[model samples]
Target chain A: MRAVVWIAEGSWQACVDQARAILPPDTAVTLLHVAPGDVEALAEGARRGLFGRHPPPPPPHGSIREISDAEAGRLLATARERLGRECETMARRGRVEREVIAACAQADADVLVLARDGERKLGPPSLGHHPRFVVDHAPCTVVLAWAQAPPAVETIPPPPRHRP
Target chain B: MSEVVALLALALALAASVARVRFAPDWAVAVAGALVLLAVGAIGLTGVGHALTRFGPTVGFLAALLVLGDGCRRAGLFDALASVMASFSHGSARRLLAIVFAVAAATTAVLSLDATVVLLTPIVFATASRLQLGSRAPMYACTHLANTASLLLPVSNLTNLLAFQAARLPFARFAALMALPWLTGLAIEWLVLRLAFRAELDVAAPQDAQADADAERRPLPRFALALLALTLAGFVASSTLGVAPVWVAVIAAAAITIGVRPRPAELVAAAQPAFLAFVLALAVIVAAAGAHGLSSAVDALLPHGDGLLALLAVAGVAAALANLANNLPATLIILPLVSASGPGPVLAMLVGVNIGPNLTYVGSLATLLWRRIVHAHDETVDIAEFTRLGALTVLPALVACTAAVWLATQVT
Candidate 1:
């Protein structure tokens, strides 16, 4: 079996654990992370903010793209550790949903795994619009991982009114 | 026939400028529209020159402000401030949120809305990410406060500056009149944001992690803070001395440039020529629109009277127009009509344009820029979700601020 696992900015340990348990030992996996294509937008915005009616010159060193590249690399590396030896990693640049669908098609994977809401968890099983877009458009079996639930009450520490 | 063609060009240019599909940069679309207007003889060179003469100073002021803001950002001033604010959270998400609000409000009030959007958004995002807090609350706060907190002074937003000059109010007088509205709008925005994000704020984040990381990488530069204080003092002093605010901004930026000696490339990046083109093009388009029909339509719709109710009506109409065509262009279209409506109506319209943009992404360039910044950080805020939040916050803010402005008018 071949799998394309989409790793975003939040916890996807559930998806990784499930992939581990379910995939055959020889399963081929592709780990994909899509950085948004809004870097130019940000640069323009920064320009507008900094210079009201001035033209923006070429960006400086340490552009957001560079930072996002490092972030994507870290995310892919962490995902690879979770998926183990059968995985190859890719970090593409574009809209999250479009890139995920394209990645799955490129890999010709039978299954796609992604977190429903990559970050913000509001105590429900609702998915982010991007993940839902992938689920609707992707040409593969899709797995939606819920955010990791909090510790059980018995294991949790008593709530304090304020931080120490 | 040329009129019809010019109108088509205008519509196409406006759509292309803000469209999701990027055929060219936004500035290119705007410039193309302006050129088309000239090509079609819809506006003569004299008309273009006239528009430029009237609108040019505001653009120059914005550029100067950007130079100064970019200098501060390059100096690590924004980052240091973010670190300090985050440190106070001390692991509590609610406290962190409060700090974000306070910082965003103060930054917007003092430096201008774009300054808050440009300098604070990324730093706040990093702070949230580093602390294991979801980026939603802090991110939203940056955009929301950029608009809501911007009514404190004429310099706080481009719309305010336009109205300030039109109303011919002195700087201190403008601030005194707006202080109440600014406070009320901010209070309403805070209440709405807090209620909307209650669940998100309840999450326990790893506190002080960002502060530790930030401290090691770039310790707070005390000189940056000193420069900022000195720059602010220049603003007040120049206002009292009856000097053009732009001179103060330019002088302060030059001083910082001398002391900081940032790279030429850094300065250029901050200048953002494309945006300047967008502003210039938008002005020409509005002028064309005015010449063609938009002005007559607005004049008809513009409420007439000096009563508080009349001012509210004018504000209501301005806010609606702002959400439809954007605040900057809306201000341009409405400025001439409102100038005759007395300072109360003009200030009320300012309130509308400033606070009303929170309702939609396209309501202001600043909001659009905020959206881009958020997306660049790899976080997504759904349009529906954003609107719901905006609707809850903006209406109350508009009402409260407009009422306050009316009260100020009565007093003054």
Candidate 2:
């Protein structure tokens, strides 16, 4: 099986581990992390400048982008260890919804696994703006993983392959 | 009755500001509120004009600082400072904690808290990864110092600038009064971080002298430093000459821009007109609240004495309110109430709002930004652990700093 699993800053490990158990032993997986040049961070940069007589210079282009890529690399490394295989990792900077869809098309995977409700660091499930976009517009079968603890591997269903 | 209606509008505006609604950004809500006030005759065009005339220069000074800070960042000044900080680690995590605290404090005081968050944080993490030290200690130091150290200078934090402008205190007067409080806050923060992260910092480290040497080899930011120095000196001089600090900040920002040659779009993007609009709108809301009895409510809460106990009480009230609505709005609401009581309460309120945010991520905009940066580094900050650490650290710092400021007020 060929699968593309989307990950974010605060996703659950169960989402990865459970999906791995259901896939064929030799399945090829692609881990995609898209860091949309966070608007919140940029607004913060602007807020700092708000007090000054002159406008602040734009956040050094790629300052947050570089940080995002490095963080994505670290996250992918962890996912790779759990999957017990070498999976392709792709990190891009742009709108999250657009990038996720583009990546799905480019990877041409049989299915895409994602946390249906966005994973927040320490809060209840945050049904973020991105998940709805991913679900509504994905290029392939979409698996909406929940944040619950890992279910028994035997009870897990086979990876769905309903391409949109 | 108009005041009552205005208060309701303001409350709705603030609620929408922080809510995660998809309709618009927080600034838009603020703008809408201000417009509503004008439309309802709660505050007239004359009142809006008055707010602008009063806050206009401070707003201009703030914009200029953002420009200079951004230009310096682009010039690689902050990175150079970070590399220099990492070099002092000497391969020991304990020593690195000391150096990180110092660097973070200086950056927050000079470049502003936002700069420390957006600029220096990544450097601290990168330095940790290179040294193979646990990143948690440094990360906490960065966020903690960003708030506490900002007590020192008007340029250090937005709240300080707002209060300074409101009080119309001299630049020197502001610094002199805050010096003790700032030092006390830093000391408490440092000690707390050390105790909380002792287990993490106790690890032995192999020195990476070669990386330090290479980092040191990069070109120095001599021009940026000169500009910064000149800017600080200009602020002092402007105050003495009775010139607004905005002039100094604008000239310095312009000079840096000339040298850095950043695109105009980059400059405008960093200006954050939305936030400026928010500030203006918030001022209008608070003004309307004053008409409705909010100021009298605050006045009634004021302690009668100028003694240490009174200072502490005022600080406590400000802190509580700050945590409720985030420091920026809280400061805006409280500023009008406290303005008539004199500089002592105003400065004390500044201490409260500034240090108060250390208690929770929602207490200040800087803290919220810190959380975002932490996640970008692939680290999770459990809210419970954060609150636990904060309870141990922030409460003490708040008390010590407020007391120090009160003492300074007495002596000076």
Per-candidate iRMS values, in order, are 6.1, 10.4
CAPRI-style quality class for the chain A–B interface of candidate 1:
incorrect
What range of 10 consecutive residues in model 2 chain B has the weakest lDDT sum?
B204-213
| Fraction of native contacts under 8 Å reproduced by each candidate | 0.10, 0.02
**lDDT (Cα, tens digit) per residue for candidate 1, span A1-164:** 89987766544556676677777788798888776554333434433432224333322324445656665686577668867776788888766688889889999999998765533534332555577688899999997775566436576556878977
Choose the strongest candidate by DockQ. 1
Residue A117 in candidate 1 has what lDDT? 58
Q: Candidate 1: how many backbone clashes? A: 7
Which regions of candidate 2 are displaced past 4 Å? A1-164, B20-22, B205-217, B364-381
- Per-candidate TM-scores read 0.73, 0.72
Model 1, stretches more than 4 Å misplaced?
Answer: A1-164, B1-9, B20-41, B44-46, B207-211, B214-217, B263-269, B362-381
- lDDT for each residue of candidate 1 in B304-389, tens digit (9 for 90 to 100): 88677787788888888777656777788898788876788888888888877778644554446545664666543235556788
List each candidate's DockQ score: 0.12, 0.04
lDDT winner:
2
Candidate 1 chain B minimal-lDDT segment of 10 residues: B205-214
Local error of candidate 2 at residue B129 (angstroms): 2.3
